[model samples]
Target: MKGLFNLGPVFGYFFRKNDPNRTSNFNLRTMHFINKLSMAMFLVGFLVLLYRWFLR
Candidate 1:
C-alpha cells in the first residue's frame, strides 16, 4: 500500500517530463481508469453486502 501510494509522483514525473502534453492527458486517462476500477469494485462490494444481508 505504501509503495502503491508513492507510485503516483513517480509516474507523474515521467508522464510530465516525457509527454509533450504536460501530463494533462495522462492525468485524465489515469483518472478515467481509476474511476472505472472503483465502480467495478463498488458493484462487487454491493453484491457481497446484499448477499450477506439476506443470508443473515
Candidate 2:
C-alpha cells in the first residue's frame, strides 16, 4: 500500500475531465461522486477513531 501514495497523479487523472468544454456524462459524474464519498468516509472514520484513542 506504500506505493499507492505515489500513484496520486495517476488516480487524479481519472478524477478530472481534461476537456472543460465537454459536457459532464454519467460515468464521469459517478466516478467523481464515488471518489468524494470514499474520501469523506475515510476522513470521518479516522477522526472518530483518533478522538476515541485520545480519550483512552
Candidate 3:
C-alpha cells in the first residue's frame, strides 16, 4: 500500500537505461513513446491547473 505514494519508480522510468533483454519492435516502441508523451502532457496540464487555481 505504501508503494502507491512512492515516486522513485516513476522518475526511474524516464531516467533508466533501456533493458537489453527486452525485444525491440515497432509496436512496443510506439506504445512506449505515446505513453511517455501522455504522462508529460498530464503533468503539464496539472501544473497549469494549479497555477490558475492559485491565481484565483
- Structure candidate 1, residue pairs in collision: none
Model 2, residue 1: displacement in angstroms? 18
lDDT of each: 0.69, 0.78, 0.87
Q: What TM-score do all the candidates reach, one by one?
A: 0.52, 0.59, 0.83
Better of 1 and 2 by lDDT: 2
Off by over 4 Å in 2: 1-20
After best superposition, candidate 2 residue 21: deviation in angstroms?
Answer: 2.2
Best-first order by TM-score: 3, 2, 1
lDDT of 3 by residue, 1-56 (tens): 99888988777877888899999999998998898889889889999999999987
The digit string of per-residue lDDT tens for model 2 on 1-56 reads 88766957745755765688878889988987898788868768988999999987
**RMSD of each predicted structure:** 8.4, 4.2, 1.7
Which candidate would rank higher by TM-score, 2 or 3?
3
Q: Give, for candidate 1, the lowest lDDT window spanning 10 residues.
A: 10-19
Error (Å) of candidate 1 at residue 10 is 31
Candidate 1 lDDT at 54 equals: 100
Once superposed on the true structure, which residue ranges of model 3 sit more than 4 Å away at CA? Answer: 1-3
